[model samples]
Target: MSDSIVSLHEPGRAVLPAYVRALEAGWSPNTMRDVAPEQLAAIAADPDAFLFGLNGRGGKIRLHDGSEVDRLPGIIRWIIAARGPESQFVGSINLRWQEDASGKPITELPPHVLGHVGYTILPDHAGRGYASAALAAVLGEARTIGLPFVRITCDADNAASRRIIEKNGGRFVESFVAPFYGPGERLMYRIDLQS
Candidate 1:
């Protein structure tokens, strides 16, 4: 299956039956929360608004706990689409990082965040290399935006994710427990785009 990443803001109505299906199956694009009825209703009412809000284009970010945080430096989200006669949404990926009032991307992540890149593949879509391809594609987007590099993090025990990160030129940086993420060590890696 050929895979492509589509920005959530792109115009035109794209069928998202797969997204609905995933939601019905108890999947959430935000790993922090499940598919809430209210969120579902909002998405159903106006998907583009929901998606644009997710991109955090100069808007406050609402966390899973109902608190809002100031928008980070630069953030964007994309749906991983499997293209064919019937296009399907397979997963979601996003890039976020520290930024200054001048709107420049800073490589360091805020304390509340673990990494610059975060992604989730629907359970059914795992093991098909979608994660790797999507991450690589998003790195191109990151490069285009003038980011010198991106830091990605995964659970230290998640070998599959580590492989995907390393396959895309990620170099091991360090491992530490993120205070905001509870316990357990998380491995951090950096992929330099300057090369």
Candidate 2:
């Protein structure tokens, strides 16, 4: 478990020494069946390497040893350092978007948007509103960056996950079956930043 303060910055060499031992708490969550946390050092070395196949969002999810990490499809992960003498990282939120409506590929980004609420807090960090706080902070960044909306998703059976989405002003969009990574059905949520 990490005990250092949380700071938002590009993952540098500073990340290796930060999360090498974070195996137990996040690797195997209380409810999630197929996710695992990664060794911090490995992720810091290769930020893009963490992104796995699409869980939703038509993109991909970052994974370290089967657990999910926040991925930045827009910018890079603005590493959130925990606040305290405790060497803990709450969660990472990123600003990015899906490939344009046409898969033909375009150079410029689409409409106004900052980061998507990529992933929430690890299992051990749940119940403290860290997920909410991290989400709020991400929305704030979108506002500062002048975006119109943000999107997020969670498993349908995950009550805690639904709460996190709702707490951040997420509206129930629709529940659908995920194709790529499937242990079960996933619930997708959306929030209009302008609303």
Candidate 3:
């Protein structure tokens, strides 16, 4: 089945069950940390609120260190779902950016965040071109949202992820360790949406 990016909060999209299963099986939407257990518990407590909160519309974000901070402006999330009679959650993708005094989006991300876009696909659904397709779609969204470009990062050792970024027109920028994402040799890439 083909995959497409869908709204995380779509009323007709019943994504929680598949999402929960992925978390239970040790898959995390965020690659920076292992917070799936906490997230799963939160989802179990209130499914609707949990789904609605994925886009950071709640205005606050809890960090892996258990600290809460105001959500960054222009943060949005979408589910990567397999399309068919029964669409299933294969993964999630998100975009975040800082805002100016007038609330316009900026390319600068928060100090702790390593990239403008981040995504993770379930282990079972890997190697199917889903991440590539999703990144391409989100780059279009980025352009529509007035971003001239987007920066994305993946672990340097993660060849598959690196390939996905390059396939989406990502140009390698640098290699460094992102302390916020823990210890790892991370490679940064930029996709110029204006092109």
Candidate 4:
């Protein structure tokens, strides 16, 4: 199986066709609420805006249950996994940076944000190990940012995501109910970057 090259999203220079393809194929970001007709048109018309809007500085975030809530404080880095340099976009990965009082990166996450890393690949690109490969690449970024470890979470029933995290050396921490996310219990995994 082929792996993807993960990099930060570049506006005018990055792959725009991939976003178009994803939109045409009806692929939405993992945390996006249902894309309305106007929103879809806007995305197609201006992908840069759509892509940049995924940045974490915003005040609101869409939950897994398709509801919106105030976002937590953290630095969010949006990334793309592509076939190669400037190639088709295979998927996306988001890394949230949390720091302690001393300004050191921390593994713990806030209530609104479930994990340190979140990712999603288009349906057509699923099952090709892209998620794992993308995650491994993102971990390099985490290391560059001086994170000691990262907390990753996924739906309890998502075996594929569990495997992806484990493939990247993630160890199960515990399962917990997110106060902001209603009844669904989420599984948490920790990947130590110091090792």
TM-score to true structure, per model: 0.84, 0.59, 0.86, 0.75
Alpha-carbon lDDT, every model? 0.73, 0.52, 0.76, 0.70
TM-score for candidate 3, residues paired by index: 0.86
Best by TM-score: 3
**Considering lDDT, which of the candidate structures 2 and 3 is the better prediction for this target?**
3
Least well predicted 10-residue stretch by lDDT in candidate 1: 3-12
Model 1 pairs whose backbones collide: none
Task: Sort by lDDT, best first.
Answer: 3, 1, 4, 2
Over 1-195, each residue of candidate 1 has an lDDT whose tens digit, in order, gives 123533232221454455666777877777666644655686799988766665446767666667778777555444555545654666777787776679777787767777788888888878877788888887887887788999999999999999999999999999999766668898999999985
RMSD of each: 3.1, 7.9, 2.9, 4.1
Candidate 4 lDDT score at position 159? 95
Q: Which model is ahead, 1 or 2, in terms of TM-score?
A: 1
Query: Which regions of candidate 2 fall more than 4 Å away from where they truly are?
Result: 1-7, 23-72, 76-87, 99-115
Candidate 3 residues 135-190, lDDT tens each? 78777778877888999998899999999999999999999986766787989999
* Candidate that would win on lDDT: 3
Record all residue pairs in model 4 with backbone atoms less than 3 Å apart, i.e. clashing. none
Residue-level lDDT for 19 in candidate 1: 61
Estimate the overall C-alpha local distance difference test score of candidate 1: 0.73
